[model samples]
Target: MFMGDGMSLPTLAAARTLLGQRAGRPGEETQLSFEAFPTVGLAKTYCVNSQTADSSCSATALLCGVKSNAFTLGLTAAVPRRDCAASQVPAARLDSVAAWALAAGRDAGVVTTTRVTHASPAGIYARAAERNWETDADVLADGVDVDACPDIAHQLVHLAPGNQFKVILGGGRREFLNITSVDDEGTPGKRTDGRNLIEEWQADKARRNVTYQYAWNHEQLLQANATLPEYLLGLFESDHLRYNLETDHTTEPTLAELTEVAIRMLSRNEKGFFLFVEGGRIDHAHHDNQVHLALDETIELSAAVARALQLLDEKDSLIVVTADHTHVMAFNGYSTRGADVLGPSNMRDSAGVPFMTLSYTNGPGRRPDVDGRRPDVTLEEGFRSPRWRTHVDVPLASETHGSDDVPVFAWGVHHEMFSGLYEQSHVPHRMAYAGCFGGGPQACDAAAAPSALVMPLVMALLALLRALA
Candidate 1:
């Protein structure tokens, strides 16, 4: 499964247009990798306590198959954010699809541009009361018992499912190291407990006698043998990976490279594997109102999905692509065909000022009017820069998520089941059905006929079973 964080319909539309223009064609005629999927659906992205869901709540819904309260990860709504006592309750703690995959004797792995302990990736294995409690210092600062509520970084390295992962690749090396220690890049770690989780992860694998490799840079990742290692842990950056436009390809791996290596290692399992690949920086860019970077990250996500497809067989494998939530970024304006998406719109405002095609509803991008007039976008230096923030109506530190349904695109192996609208929580259940894992009805079960060709037989067996009972 793959998710583009904060990649809304408008975001995809804009990225596709930008892609087409880059391909030297009319911008509207292009399709991203997932757009060609046979089954397409929409998922409502509201949380249990909020109309507009944050990454943690949405990640819980998408990965755990349950809607959770805002700011919580891998726990049900019964556990409110920052409730350390409540989060410890096993009933309140939810198991994600990774647990389900492991229960069925399949391996699972996670790859993201964000820190492994960040909200989205943490949903796979972490059971936390708060998303921001990524380190011991963070939990203690929030007045929570550090030992009782272990930080997310500790949970991933020492806990179940996460330790069993065949592949764990992403940024955030600092989260796994101690404050006193520095990484190869001389970056200080974030842990205050004086424990280095990265070394612990390596030591654990060593004790198990498994072939594992730990990589901290692009060269290290490339040098690691994909087939020889039973496990792999790669942390490319101290924080989140750099924006695609700013990254040095020699030191930092692209999203596509990470996805490719993950697939190569995970596909070795005969029982199959469940991999979660996330373009997490897309959300970060949108939060900063950097439309160019957001679009580039979306394109990077498409490339990653394409790489996964190239390595898998459609006959047996399943690929589902969707977003956790939408953003407040708006792509508007009428311009001539093949016009630059990054350029100003053809239609001017009431003040005869041309605004960029992209803009945010609320962000630091909001510029104060001069003499009761909107500034001309074309006149500003760095206006077309990748880090440029477009126009905004409301002034805020960061843009918020939009309360809109996200699109779901599914391909391969009973993809038809993904058709039509559904709640965000049902996503993993549908995936479990297709993969024949978890407690729910599955394609492997005779009574659950996902395909039309077997509906009659399924009905006959259902009737016979009811009669027998």
Candidate 2:
């Protein structure tokens, strides 16, 4: 399963329809399919009604098989009202698939294009108060309620009695470093709590027979061999990793690179593994209404999925790919194959046709200038106006997530379990069921017992092959 970020079922369906029609010949029609997890119906049935399927609840549902209130991780809706299990004293919470894998002695890892503490990946490991609340010196020194779930950084270090995860990679150095600790660039800072989380992690790893390596850049990551560390930490920045579209000072690794490294490290475990990879920035792009940025991130996510397919053996390993939620995107007109993905706004008139094309719907106080012309300066500089001028008119509304059901695609042992639409919370349970983590017949049971007992396609092919040979 390859999950794309902010993928709207309706928008994707429209795009596929256009692509098929454009690709089809007079007599032939092309069929297009959506492979991300579908959205749940009945309002709070699939998701807790919130402003959006923000990563916190979405990821919680994906990983823990529970729908949480928005912004809370690893807690049930009754957490606020009833003080659920996660809100209690931390012994060892095993709600996450990652935790289940760790408990089963299988290696587990999480890789993301955002801060490891961010909602999507953190949903797998850390059960915290709010996704946005990272541990600051002031917050911690105030004798923060230990019973209140800690941030991802604290959870990564102290989730299990022992360091549980074998591999942990992605940004969020600020969360690990003391509030006062300056970054390697000699930047001045202070550890607010006067305790260095990185040192604590290293010391803990050394004492617990765990090898630990923390890498801040691509060079450091490449230098550290798979043999060195059973537990790895790669936080390339203080916050979210740099987006692939933006060139920045930070040495961020692409999602594909991070996935490859994690697979190599985690596969060494004999018990097999479960890893969660997130293309988190895609959702961010959608929130900002940057379609081009969103599509680019989606393509990168596809590349990572392709990498997973290349690395994993389908016979033993189950790779479940899915997104937490959907964004509201649409395709109003017929768009040709490989049409300027950035579209006409970036083009200029070649002849009688107006060539340069770019577009956007209404966003943040955007209005036409006096003459209905493009603003002189950049969109960022143009206040009280919409950016990304467009000839196409969309419904006047802020961008949002659609209520429509999304799609999920699966391949490998239990891939068939993902065939039909299901509730978002059912995903983790399905994967766990397939992976043999949950108590049930493995996904292969479904695969082995086919419906209606049709003739063996393999046998038919073999007979044809023998005849041809």
Identify the leading candidate in terms of lDDT: 1
Worst 10-residue stretch by lDDT in candidate 1? 446-455
Give lDDT tens digits, candidate 1, residues 86-194: 9998899888999999999999999999999999999999999999999999999999899899999999999887888898999999988889999989999998999
The numbered model that scores best in TM-score is 1
Q: After superposition, how far is residue 42 of candidate 1 from its true place, in Å?
A: 0.3
Residue 384 in candidate 2, Cα distance off native in Å: 20
**Can you write out model 2's per-residue Cα lDDT over 319-413, one digit (the tens) per residue?**
66666777655543344444443444233333323322233343332344435554432333532122242332344445555555555656676
Clashes per candidate, residues 3 or more apart or on different chains: 0, 19
Q: Assess each prediction's global lDDT (C-alpha) against the native.
A: 0.92, 0.62
